[model samples]
Target: MHHLFMVTLKTEQSKRKQAFFWINAMAPLTSVILGSILVYMTHAEKHGVQVIGHLKKGLNPPSVSELGFGSPYLMTAIKAGATIGIISLAEGVAVGRSFAMYKNYHIDGNKEMIAFGMMNLVGSLTSCYLTTGPFSRTAVNFNAGCKTAASNIVMATAVMMTLLFLTPLFHYTPLVVLASIIIAAMLGLIDYGGIIHLWTIDKFDFFVSISAFLGVVFGSVEIGLIIAVTISMLRLLLTLSRPRTYALGNIPNSITYRSIEQYPAAANVPGMLILRIDAPIYFANTSYLRERISRWIYEEEDRLKSAGETSLHYVILDMSAVSSIDASGIHMLEEVRKNVDRRGLQLALANPGSEVMKKLDKSKMIEKIGEEWMYLTVAEAVGACNFMLHSCKSTSAALTNPAAVEPNTYDYV
Candidate 1:
């Protein structure tokens, strides 16, 4: 009831009317008090009602001496603390940002983390558990319509009063009432709409959500964390190992070339296969790329043969997007060059960047492919291939000058 506010309560508060507003605000307190009184009157503890039992009145004794820094279990304690701390930080910040977005407010993440760290450090000395802005209590506070953090000060004062004077009153309070309050607060956080939206948008994300949720409910929070992390890493590795490749074609009336699949009007040049790699070349994807390139060449040849088009003559690789390459990538290039030569097709490289040129220089690959075969741009490579094709008289006239094809100049290291 405290979570719900009536519209009438907001309008013009007189002395008596304002006094009545406190009733809605203190509904949880009323419930606790009535539950405690009823339990006490019925002597429910004797009937196994599981009351709160004795309450300690006073302050926390310093537990600094219990640090056990020199104990043999120090390493284990450190490991446990580090694990729980990581999970706590992840969950707290995630929930905090959600509420911050919902409320349309801003918060400094670094300050929030620093405050939590200081609180936990100080709290540990006073025998308190590790502190975090957990979702349960956060949801409860949000539902109560807290306008500002000053509510925490009021709550702290009330708690202090309870500890100093009202300890005996809660001794008969049933644990069920407290649990019910927490459960009610947590019910607002289920977010079924979010789960359904995830399923509609992305199956993988939905799978991750369900896996984490079920793991936490059945196994443990740590197990859920492990599952989520494992699935995410697997997805990352799969994407890297099979990075996208595009069959490029020239955009009409322009020197620009783009993916044939992406640009429907882009026309494919006869007797040539132009391909683009959309990711960096690395050891993880080297083998996959080798097979993928071979497959592209094979598929292009098959498509040409089926259509009775000009025989596949040249294989042009657009290296504009390949930012980096390792030794394995260099080897893959060599293997691809050899395969193209074996298939009686001329292989040309175009627009490889400074880093790729440097790697090629280091591997003595520029000398093998030669300066005449490498071009400053894919369009220039296509021009050289078209000159070699002997299909168009006007294109032949355009490429009559040898300097028409600009080759990349690389200084070997």
Candidate 2:
């Protein structure tokens, strides 16, 4: 019936609303009424069908004195409670955020976490088990065009009234009917289209989604949650371990520097190499950065040698994107500087942030590298290197070729 309603509904908004209402509300209600009638009109017991045989009357009594906080089991209970509490909170927040986005509203995640934590704390005192917003019920509420959380209030009131007065009415309710209602509500949560969309956009994201799905289907819900979270953390770690490093080149007729791979039209400066790091310099990535920078230097030198151009004499690091660095990162930079010096090339830094400046100053590296080598911009650093190279060439020309009348007139290009 749920599938039929979904398929037969028209494209009009009113028809969609009717479908949502029927599948989410009326269908379950109708199933319960029919089940009650079947049990009343027939000998349901002889058919081996189970019915609600009995129900306790009245509201739950207070259990304030039942609080347990003793010995070995107390610590175990705390650990288990915390684990389940975190998992439930994560699920509830994800569901809330999704609906909030769809409804064009904002939700403060931290505030939501606090609210959930407080609710659970109070609920425990009141003899309630761990409570969370179930996705199936949330989907039904959303589909019913609920304007606010007042719907939940209405639902709770209805449930309270049912427990207070309608307990006898549910005595003949069949277990199969209740199961049908649950199955119908849960069917709407299966989103095959979303999986296909993920596959088309990103294979890794599709893998994660499918892994979670299969894990839940084959293993337990806990296993699926663990697998999904583990995969996500691994992906984050992989990105940090291999952060992107780009060889920057100057845009023709402009001082702007960009990645040569991204902007193929950008040209490399003569007798100088510029490199950019695109993430924070941290201990985890320092080794990778060192090797990557070394590779860029060797590749640039090979290209210069093949072209029969002036050998690379200066390497300017564009540090604008490196917002922070650690001790290992600083050590890596020192090692890079030493390697460049061994290769008879000058190493310069451009636009180092205040934090990096302070660290370098404290480490006494700035004085060793000379404050004059650090420039405000990549363009300024390249220009200074070019001027120094031109001066050296002019002096060499004057010394080697004394017949030349004008030393400044010697062309270094």
Candidate 3:
């Protein structure tokens, strides 16, 4: 009854919302009263149905002195605290974000973190339970139509009153009734659309989600979190170790170049190969890039041979996307240069950033690669290659005069 009342209120008249809200609000209390009466009237407690027996009517006592800061198990406590704290923090922030996105609202993450941190800090002294917002509680409050932080104030006040004077009222309340209410609230939070969307867009994310769900269902929250994190890290490392590269081609009647696979109409310049790296050049991906570049060269040669087109002469690397390079990257480039030289091809670099330029200069690669071969953009690189090969009709003529080249200059099969 606490879960679906919001939908009922939405369907009613605007003026009737206020009246229906009170009735919806009374459902839980009514259930508690009725369940307690039933349990009492039927003597269910004596028949093994558990109930919240007795009452403790008082304010919290000081537990500061009970804290064993200097105990021998302090290190163990710290380790456990750190692990649980991290998992709780991540879960709390994630829940806040999920609800905020669902309701089309914004929340300041830093403010939320600080507020939860302060709550936990003060709570520790008073022997209060750890205070990160749990998803089940958030779902219940969300279904109850809580609009702002004021709901927390109301909750705190009600809890205080319950501790002081209303303790005896719940003494005969059946625990099963409360559990059922919580389960119903949680059921409303399971988003079927999100799961299907993830499955359609990204299979890996869907698999990870399933793994976490299974872990939590069969084991515990910690187990689920660890499995999700491990799979995520593995994916990250895999992508970093083998970053993707693309073959760029000129767009007809335009100076811009883009991936040929993406733009099927883009034209490939004869006698030259253009490639772009989509990640930083580092030790992790350098070796894979070397083999991949070699394969591209061989493949280009085979295609040109089959077409009886202009023999491959130049290899231009569009380095605008490659932001940085390390020692292994420099070595990989040196090896690539040697390989290109052995194939009787000239190697050219286009749009190397400041970081890459500095590393290349320090490694004496700038002098070896020749400053004259380096161009500011891929168009200029292609123009130079075309001019050298004396096939200036498509690329070089297009750069010198926009209208000199024909549309669909040179399409790759």
lDDT to native, each model: 0.82, 0.81, 0.84
TM-score of each: 0.77, 0.87, 0.84
Best by TM-score: 2
Q: Model 2, 41-159: lDDT tens per residue?
A: 89695589898877876777667888767766998888998899888988788778767765679999999899898988888777777888666677656644467879889988988
Poorly placed runs, candidate 1 (over 4 Å): 1-27, 65-68, 97-113, 147-158, 319-324, 349-381, 387-413
Runs off by more than 4 Å, candidate 3:
1-25, 391-413
User: Candidates sorted by TM-score, descending order?
Assistant: 2, 3, 1
User: Between 1 and 2, whose lDDT is larger?
Assistant: 1
Name every residue pair that clashes in candidate 1: none
Instruction: Name the weakest run of 10 consecutive residues (lDDT summed) in model 1.
Output: 3-12
Q: Model 2: residues >4 Å from true position, as ranges?
A: 1-24, 43-53, 68-72, 102-104, 190-193, 216-223, 402-413
* Candidate 3 lDDT, 262-352, residue by residue in tens: 9999988888899998889999999999999999999999999999998899999999989999999999999999999999999999999
